[model samples]
Target: MNRFRPVRTMVAAGTVLAAAGTAHSAWNSTALRTPPPDPPPVTEYVSLLMPVRNEAGRVGPALRSLLAQEHLPRAEVIVLDDQSTDDTGDVVRRLCGPYRHARVVRGTAPKPGSPGKAHACHQLASLARGSVLVFVDADVVLASHAVASSVALLRSTGLDLVSPFPRQAAEGPANRLVQPLLQWSWLTALPLRRAEASPRPALSAANGQFLVVDATALYGCGGFAAVTDEVLEDMALIRALKRAGGQGGIVDGSRIARCRMYDGWRDLREGYGKSLWTAFGSGGGAAAVCALLVWAYVVPPLAALRGSRWGAAGYVAAVTGRTLTARRTGGRCWPDALAHPVSVGLLVALTARSWLGHRRSTLTWKGRPLRGWH
Candidate 1:
């Protein structure tokens, strides 16, 4: 009887987490709200910044979306081809030629100890002349009102910066298992209301794909230069801004922007492996999170297959939580939710690989080594 004690304990813990995750998902659904419609004829001018590298075939839709903005005259688009080996520069130049305000600039190499993306962003800021600076990733497609609404949200709330985390579009096997977990991690764990209200750096969240900030505030916090070495530059910038006494927080932008972050299994794996270990702060924190996930998400399904009724209920609750999160974030949930354990397992594996790669100096992205991944 004592030999089964650990299994019984795991079953009980799984039940508790499933209940908590379900409740947390429910709370997030109620708390997350869409940004208000953009005021007509938005007077505030915005510099839309793009940093690209080897995005030849995939960046066209994003460029098209930016050029077709309904609030165009108030927006100036700037593209920095960060020393691409492909035709990314040509794609940008050809697509943006008709827009009088659009300009493409050649990006220089990063200074020592600085991440390439952060350096590219800092260079873009030097060329921008707008009061509002919008940093957009090359893979994101913004809605017609995305810029206008983001600016309006900032103006109305009196915040210095706002990160409108776009809806993640995941396809293929790996993506279907892993992408939805991005939004779920914060939505269920961070308590959005508190994060929004708190100015603490640890509570802040930001997505690089669609970050909107007041130009003055960004410069005030030293722009991306403040987080030059950070692998997660987006979230680091938010933290730096908050520590600099500027108020900023995340908002639900599922209605305004969509991003397909990686192409397939290999891309997705390395994409995550480049930063997952550092995401939770330290080795200890990463270990704790991984253990928790294994217990909360992975174990129940295994026990269920072994004919444990309570474990089956826990699996149902976990799936319900994922479904609720997907409903809110505009992701696929049906089959993916059923594979929640698989997703968590993949995340754990990626995180372990990330730490190992960092130790071995093998972690890289777009030909740049992630030196600060430790």
Candidate 2:
């Protein structure tokens, strides 16, 4: 019974442990919100660009949202179509045909072994006319003043790069657990406000979904050329910007941008699969850490239920802590919290598969293989 006690207790402990983890995470949850403060007004030209690859359904709404924005009515929008099999090119053409500032340009894949996004963005940057260059993923939708608000921040702070933390729209059972968990993890890892308050070049939070870069500084800092091979382009870009004596931070995209990320769980899985392993880096060490994290929450609850009240209590404490932390970070619906165990499991499995795919360089996104994943 004693041997089995810990096992049983682990089950009970999982809940408590998760709670505790959430609690610790709450302290750093401000990364999700855009503080009410606005950047001082300054004269800065901005151009918005979107690089699309077979994003027909989502592109229209995304573009429409931008056209409707009250800020930067003159901000030119350029969509770089990346050889899509779908009517992505047609959609971009039709959606913005009436707007003179809105334009669509075609993009080609980089030569074998060269990174695709950096290459494409390099081309887009060349044609871009704004003093401030912005890259919004095709899936990203902008708020009426998102461009205005963001540019204001950059000008006011004199920062080199700006990225928004998006408010994701997720549906179905699978999205409920995994997406929120993923966001929570981000909230836990980076404390943006504190980073901004410090002087030692801390706090690295970004979402490629809505990345804004200063055109001149980008060139001065070696541009995307510096991070040509990085799988996590957003983070790499931010790091490069900082290394080049620039500042990077996240802003409230709620007023500036919105992203659904994927149409379904499979889409989410494949998308994350292509980049997750790379996000954590080579070897299977990332897998080990992920598994351990999931088990940390899963085990405690089981133990608590089995009779080792102490273990069970500890786990419950942990889980409660995690829950509180999540609420502070940005609340997910209650059902997602209930389904966290399964969500965590799916994430681990997906991450493991991603790592395998990365090792073999077999990961693909939107029908394009991510070259040099390993």
Candidate 3:
């Protein structure tokens, strides 16, 4: 067992190194370039849809940014107020008042089996009249060219759906440690170009923060109605699209949008806890992923502290992958990458918390009980 230990270390180090290489390749291949300052005219009518609930404090800037979008020949902005206890609806109405093309829609409570966000999105999609549907989250602020550039990429790539992952804005310690992992995990683990080309649902990924989809393909896939109960509805939507013979994948939207997902540590913990259980499909899958992450990222650092050269190499490789992902995704790179192991640990803890919440029937997001947890 002692002799085989060195071989195990070597294999583990190699896996980490391979992940680093994958991250490098994904960065080069998956980046979304800014469209030309003066691009061809877009004839397709685009509808920018947003669903807001308890976002009074943050929705203003995001809505303002959406309304300020330029270069769309024909466009409409539709915001659905999803029964917020706060002034979310009023705030959106005030911001949208001056824009004749933009309007606010009153949303009803979700059906028993539906998730709030998905239900809200389903309603917004039904109201959309555009040939293209761009869903922007209330917390996501877009650049003036965000809509135009994303539309250009969608048409140019011929993909049915494209998720431009916004640059995550992290402020607290918890945020800084875990936020970068959002992009890094997929960038290091998934083959970006292959995921786009493949029809396999398991190869798909998406971010709802700023997603662009062809309306026809979306309707064909059953739209948000197909993913009404999913906690991770963005991924579910993309998978549904692929299963329906449509192509969809993610892109580096850091240049075009930014989002701060949580207010602080407490908010971050609850936010992740609400949905992380569903991220892996099952508790067993969650355990496997946690174990794999620990072995690939956490174990090497511990062994390196014990003077193992192979372990040191693995640690370096892990950090290199994180650094590459950060550089590509506009995240904080330097000291944050060094804390990759901590991030993995926190993720595991969050996954565990998510499962526990489900078991106890305590899982909720924004004060609503999560549906379909069983």
Taking all chains together, each candidate's TM-score versus the true structure is 0.95, 0.85, 0.94
- The model with the greatest TM-score is 1
Model 1 lDDT per residue over 21-113, tens place: 889878977876567766455687889999999999899999888877776467799999998998999999999999898999999998654
Q: How far is candidate 1 from the true structure (C-alpha RMSD, Å)?
A: 1.6
Which tens-of-lDDT digit does each residue in 1-374 have in candidate 2?
Answer: 68965665555455555555565566555444452334443356678888888888878888887766554644788888987899999998999899888888999777675447877777788888889998888777777667777777766677777776666777766666677665566555556665543334335656778887789888887777677687677777776676777777676565456678877878888888877786654455676668566766555545555666655565555545446544653446564565555666777888888887876888777676777644
Error of 2 at 353 (Å): 0.5
Candidate 2 error regions (>4 Å)? 1-20, 30-42, 113-115, 194-203, 308-331
Q: Against the true structure, what is every candidate's RMSD?
A: 1.6, 3.5, 2.1
Q: Candidate 2, 295: how far from true, in Å?
A: 4.3
Clashes of 1: 0
lDDT of 3 by residue, 1-374 (tens): 79977767655665565466555645654544333444466789999999999999889889999999988879999999998999998899999999999999999998664459988999999999999999999999999988898899889889998898899999989999999889888887777777886878678899998899999999998999998878889999999998889987888788889999998999999999888988888889899988888878888787788777777777888888888888888899889989988998999998998899888878778878875668
TM-score: which is higher, 1 or 2? Answer: 1
The clash count of every prediction, one per candidate, is 0, 45, 0
Backbone clash pairs for candidate 1 read: none
lDDT of 2: 0.69
